[model samples]
Target: MSVLLVLPIVLPLLAAALAIIAYNHRTLQRIVAVGALIAVVADSVFLLLAVERDGVQSVQMGGWPAPLGITLVVDMFSALMLVISMVTVLSVLIYAIGQPGVDQDQPVFHPVYLVMTAGVALSFTTGDLFNLFVAYEITLAASYVLITLGGRREQIRSGMTYIIINLLASTLFVVGIAWVYAATGTVNMADLAVKIAQLPSGTQTALSMFLLVVFGIKAAIFPLFFWLPDSYPTARMPVTAVFAGLLTKVGVYSIIRTQTLLFPQHRPSTILLVCAGLTMVIGVLGAIAQNDMKRILSFHIVSQIGYMILGLGLFSVAGVAGTVFFIFHQIPVKTALFLATGLVEQSTGSTALSKVGGMIRRTPLVAALFLLAALSLAGIPPLSGFVGKLGIIQAGLSAGEYAIIGVSLVVSLLTLFSMIKIWNGVFLGTAEDPTLRLAASEGETRLATPLLMRGATVALVGVTLAIALFAGTLFDLSERAAQGLLDPSAYIEKVLG
Candidate 1:
């Protein structure tokens, strides 16, 4: 059982190595990616069941014991994140294969993607603070390469800014780790949680706040989010889709983890609550200002990040549980919307609302998928997004944070307007160029939408619908995750035993 804990990270590393050697063979790359994705999905199922049946599972590395070795712990929270991350990456990988302009002959993209998967998995599983930092760098490095893959001018420019910002954040992370280690004399997360209480209050406050800012940078909090919109829109479609889906959330996850594990204090709570309110307001306004599909979605990512932080700020069982559920719901919906937008770009040659029109008539299936995801983003009923938002809002109101609640309400309403804005311009309005529409109708020159791409969209839409339909079970699972996080001795024991 413990051996199974390593498979998610190991499998991807192995697959990436094999794919690197088979770079010249597109078919081989495809097979490797599919195989890796299947293994990840299978691992996700096994982890979920293990947590369900046996409670949280932990594995200490190299036969060492707690506080002395690297540990991989799989609680309900980690397992669910693993599953959601797998689903998003797998779908994006499939969609990437279907993308029109991706050069499969270059092994760099697929291998880097696998490495990124491993990084996310490791970040979720690791019990050591330094190991988490290492995992983050591994993922960040891979993403940097992926962002700059095409060498387009915009990609290069955006990628440079992305690298600089992340590098600065990484430096801060290292400094925080050093400070934590100096104070606690150990780098293990579970150990730090225990020793943290014994530290001097000033030391604890400084270290914890420093760590929060570090994670906040990655999470794209209101003031720390300037790099997101500029950098996100410059990546290739699949790259942007996957990044939109998972990367920033890694930061959010870290914030939740650190707050719950090491700094469950009023100071962190107060700061996070204020940050959440501001993030919502700032992100939505950014969205309102964008006319491009990808850019708008990119800003909304920051907006939604606020919701997740709102849960963390409340520091209650319902709050954490709701946040966990929201993160899970957001991953697929965000990626699916990005993929739909990519398809629109593929067929219409632009993601600008002005350049894209009549998508509902031109590509009905893709348009439907986009609308479903957008509605989900807006927290509409009968979707997973609504369930998650309801939980968060209820938690917020119940906690008597009415101002935050009001802000959350405003953000949601503005989010709806932004969604409707895209919906009207791209799918409802007339195509600005009649000749382009005429060219679109001519079968001889019509852009061929691949079956894999369509299948991916259908599959993601199914996930969104299923999550909505089975929201009760999902929320319960998140509740269990929240409980596990609140009392992480089980995680520490498993990893360190």
Candidate 2:
């Protein structure tokens, strides 16, 4: 259990070290990344199986007890998130190695990516509030570097906005932590949960609201989402994919964790509900207005986050479960689509809908993969997105939130329309150059060539189809994870005992 808890964080940290040491060697960096990804996948699988069979478990570092030493809790929810996160990282790693923008031998890129991965793993598993803060900082610092990796005028300008916004959010996070700790004497989440409700209602509410704003910024819900669209698109392809995949979801995870565990009876559902509705409406509108593929996807990320939070705001088991399920669906689909967009940009030298054209006539396989991913994003039937959206709508209707249901439905439709716009513009239009040929067939393939960037387009297309086909099994897993999160006393006792 301890091994499972630690391996996800440790694997990436060790890989980052190796990457730094092998800074000038592209092959070594790729080997380290692949090896670390394999270990992460294995660890996540082992932990997932262990939790399913034996229930929630926790491990205290250095063999010390909790409250005094750090602890990593592997509840069904955390374990499931761990698995999804690792899978996203592995996919993005393959995509990164394939993208021409990435300097695999760049001294800092691989190492920073590994650090970000480790930070995300730690953030999901940590049992203490201060530790969570530190984990978040680790992720943020790594991301700041990643957002500027290209160092282009646009990337830097966007990176500055990202850095400023996140730094402020981090400061607020610290302030909230101080208040929570001052109010309750300990920073262990389980302990805080037990103690928090005992505080005066006003105090509890204040703390809850404070944390909400802190995480709300991270989650990009409502007005707090302004930083996302401006910043995300400027990064390189794989960097954008990885950032799109994990960062906002981590924010949502924190919102879910803190709400369910520490403030189970906190009555901010109305506030959250209103925010979620607004977020979806505004985000999708932003997406519709964008011509850039990356910008459109970034806005959609904000919009989709609203759906997840709406599930959380409903404060029902099914709603929370639906959020979890959708989160699982969204991570891979979003990143894969972004990765596919990267390919389009790579081929056409642009991500703007106006600039990208005739992908089907040129790179048919890439076009197919993008279609699968985009259709899934639009929540089409028989795809994983449909399963997730159905759950949320079911939860909303059951709770009698017709307005939410209506808005969500409208959002879904508009989302489909927006996706189609991209499809028509980028895939179906006349070829941009009318002379561009496939990169792989034009040149010789080598042993070290990145597959997904080159011939692996077909393979990625297959993987996306597989995810769409296996929606049932994944939905069930997410349901179980949500149930575990809603009743975390079992998790608390197992970890602290």
Candidate 3:
């Protein structure tokens, strides 16, 4: 089981090297990329089951003991995140494969994507603060490449902003890590948990706030989220979808891990709650103002992140459980929406609502996929999003957080309205051009979306429905994860003993 812990990170790195070596062989790159991601998914699932059955797993990198060596830890939370991240990457990779432009830029896309996958896996499992920073850098480096792959003016401009902001955030992260190590004499997370508790309250609070700011930037919390909408919408669809689905969640996960383990007794719940409310309100307002599908979804990412933070702010078992479940639900649903939008762009040469109308008449299946994913995102009933949102709201109510509850309800309504806006703008209105009445008709050469792309989008939609179907078991796993977070003694004992 401990050996399985390293496979997820190692496999992708090795695959990335292979991909670069076979850069000219596009077919081989595809096989290597998809095969590696599939292996990661399998490994992640096995780790999840193993953690559930036997408890938290840890591996020492060079066989040195903890507090002196690098460690990879896989509790329920980490394992669950790993599984979902891999699944999302795999789905997006399939979609990317069906895009010829992506293959035309094969040398850059394949290897960098694998490196990004590895980075995401490492970020979830690493037990040392420095390694977490390294994971983030690796992920961001790959993202810089992926986002600016074609060197289009908009992509390059947006990628520059993305790079500058993240570099600043990374600098802060390193400074914070250095400060922690200076204070504690150890960078190992579990060990730091014990040492941090011994520090003065003021010192601890300062450190906590510093790290929060670092991750808040990455997670795209209210004030720190300005870079996301601008940067995300300029990327190609597969790149945007992967970033939307996985990257911000990594930041949220880090916040959960650090807040739970290192500062359990001194959570900044009030601050987080305030930020959550503001993020929800501001993000949705931006979404409502957008006339483009990608921009709307990108802003919604900021809005949805607030729900997870809201759950975390509640600081209860149910709150953490809901946050975890919501992260899981949002990843697939959001990715599916982006993939559907990508299909729209490929078929209609635009994602602008004004340019791409009447998709319901031309491509009903794509419309259906987008509608299902949009409704799920808006927390419509019987979908995964609804289950996750209900849990969070109930938890907030239980905690007597009436203000946040009211805010959440308002946000959900706004989310639904934003979804409807996209629906009406993209699918409901009459086609802007009369000759483009039917999809793939001789007059509509540009409106032919590949079957493979549509299939991949449909597969992600199925994942969202499956989450709803298995909500009971998934929520139970999330609850157990939350319980572990609320009480980190078991994790500490395993990692530092």
Candidate 4:
């Protein structure tokens, strides 16, 4: 079982090397990339089952002991993250394979994509602070390549900003790690749990606030989030989709993991609640102000992140459960939405809402996919988004967090408004562009929406629907995972043993 924990991280790294070796053989590259992710997905499912049935799974690399070696562990939360992240990554790769320009001529895409997958797996499985930092560097370094893959002027411009901001966050993260390691004499997360609590109140408080800022920037929460909308909208659609789906969520996962493990609190923190509220309001407000599909969706990523953080902010079982379930809802839907928007872009040669219209006629299947995903994003009933939001709102109400709850409701409605704006502007409005009036196959050489792309999107939406249908079971798992976070004695014992 411990060896099972290493499989997810190792498989992708090995396949990435294979992909690089097959660089000139594009078919082999595709196989290596897709097959590697598929294997990861299967392994992750087994890992999740193993964790749920057994307990936290831990492994010390190179036959070394805990606190002195790289320890990788997975509880329910990290296991859930692994499963969903792999699905989203694999689905997007399929979409990219079908799209003509995405990875068609480029051999570097597959290897780099696999490297990013390995990095994400490492982030989920790492059991220590320094390894977490190393995992982040791995993920972000790959993202730097992915974001600027085409080397377009806009991509370089946006990627530079993205790179610079992430570098700042990385630097702060190092300082935070150094401070904690210096105080505790070890970076092992479970060990730090014991040592950090022994620190003086003032030191703990300072460390808590400092690391929150570091992760807040990485998670794109509130004022720290300005870089995301600017950075994501210019990338290739698959690149943007993967980034929107996985990267910020990794930061949010880190916040939940570290804050709960290293800086346990008995009650909700007002500072976190304030950040959550403002992140929601400001993000949706930014969404409403955007006319481009990519930019609008990008802002919503920041906004949706607030909901997850809000649940964590409550620092209660229900709240954390809500956060977990909302995260489950978010990963698939965000990826699906971006992919759908990509399809929309393919149909009309633009994601500008003002320029492209009447997609309902041009690409009926795509319009349906987009509408279903958009409705889910807006929290329409019985969809995964609604179930996720319901859990969060219900938990908040239970906690008597009335103000942020009100803000969340308002933000939900505003989210609907922006989705409607995209709906009306891109789907229902007149076909202002002649390109929008014709499918790529009909006459438009610059536009395309292949079946494989649509199939991949539909598969992700199915995952979203599956989440909605199985909401009760997932909520139970989330509660269990939350309980583990609130009481990590077992995790600590297992890691240190």
Which candidate ranks first by lDDT, i.e. highest?
Answer: 3
The order of the candidates by TM-score, greatest first, is: 3, 1, 4, 2
lDDT-wise, the better of 1 and 2 is: 1
> Candidate 2: which stretches are off by over 4 Å?
431-450, 454-464
Backbone atom clashes (below 3 Å) for every candidate: 0, 0, 0, 0
Q: What C-alpha root-mean-square deviation, in Å, does candidate 3 show against the real structure?
A: 1.3
| TM-score against truth, every candidate | 0.98, 0.95, 0.98, 0.97
What's the lDDT of the predicted structure labeled candidate 3? 0.92
> How much lDDT does each candidate structure score?
0.89, 0.85, 0.92, 0.90
Show pairs that collide, candidate 1.
none
| Model 2 clash number | 0
lDDT per residue (tens digit) for residues 167-255 in model 1: 99999999999889888899988888888988878888888889989999999997899999999998888889999999999999998
Candidate 4 residue runs with Cα over 4 Å from true position: 266-268, 434-448
Tens-place lDDT per residue, model 4, 107-209, is: 8899999999999999998998999999999899999999999899999998999999999999999999999988999999999999999899889988988
lDDT tens digits by residue: candidate 2, 223-319: 7999999999998888888888789999999999998898976858899899999999999999999988899999999999999999998888788
Q: Give the clashing residue pairs of candidate 2, or none.
A: none
- lDDT score for residue 89 of model 3: 92
lDDT tens digits, residue span 350-403, model 3? 787776677899889999999999999999989999999999999999999999
